[model samples]
Target: MNEIELTIEQSKIYNGVICPYCKGISEMIKSKEIYGKDYGWLYICKPCDAYVGCHKNSKRPLGRLANKNLRKLKNEAHRYFDKIWKLKILDRTKAYNWLSEQLNIPFDYTHIGMFSEKTCRTVVEISKRALNDNRRLDMDFGVEPVTEFFETI
Candidate 1:
């Protein structure tokens, strides 16, 4: 990533977050609390069964805690969205820029981890549409990601 891209990603570092589902405070606990095995830390809301993973080796939450349904949507969103850059349709940064433009969201707010269900659906829709139109996208941009996105998220 360039200095500017690095700066943008670093700017939104999430230290802690209120649970979006229940409006409760999330607790930072070992991943085993929910995963049945230790992987890393997770910020979670017990009553609502909502949770979000943290960045590796950090106490900061990745994003807002998600309920089960929203988590599924996030996975689907990633599946489609990742392909755009993975297949070299556009360079990772440009792929995100394209998504940002298409979604009319700012580039800094474009990560799928922070998206709501509605936005996740839109991401899937647009990503699928873009992937289907990959040849044109490849011809149009002919670029793809400098670094891998977070897999645990």
Candidate 2:
């Protein structure tokens, strides 16, 4: 590509980012602008009123910029889904793989950050059901995890 074309492409992905909600260009700024204290960096779209955080020490977005409701859904999804691994029903990686299989999505696209609101709700439902069932688990105190039976949920 020519220099001008390359520059345009770079602008599209650089510190001035894109708002997934509005498709408008977002600007990278310190987290203090939104949070009242410097937590890290974020890409904010003022007109659309959306933002997303960057990876630690990097400008790459953790996920798409979304509205408030979607952010709340993501948090709720994490609350339910985290128990599968946090309770040692499966290790973190295997828990993710189980969720991927349940959703019929590749592992790469199965993150809560990447999920639609519907998908987040599904994760919450599935995770809650899986944990509550405990069909594969023995009566032990969350010590003996039967990873194979996560499929039953």
Per residue, candidate 1 scores C-alpha lDDT tens digits across 35-72 of: 89887899888898888898888877777688899899
Candidate 1, after superposition: displacement of residue 105 in Å?
1.4
- Evaluate all candidate structures by whole-model CA lDDT and list the values in order: 0.74, 0.74
Off by over 4 Å in 2: 1-16, 135-153
Using TM-score as the measure, the top candidate is 1
Q: Which 10 consecutive residues of model 2 have the lowest summed lDDT?
A: 1-10
> Which pairs clash in model 2?
none
* TM-score per candidate, chains pooled: 0.77, 0.76
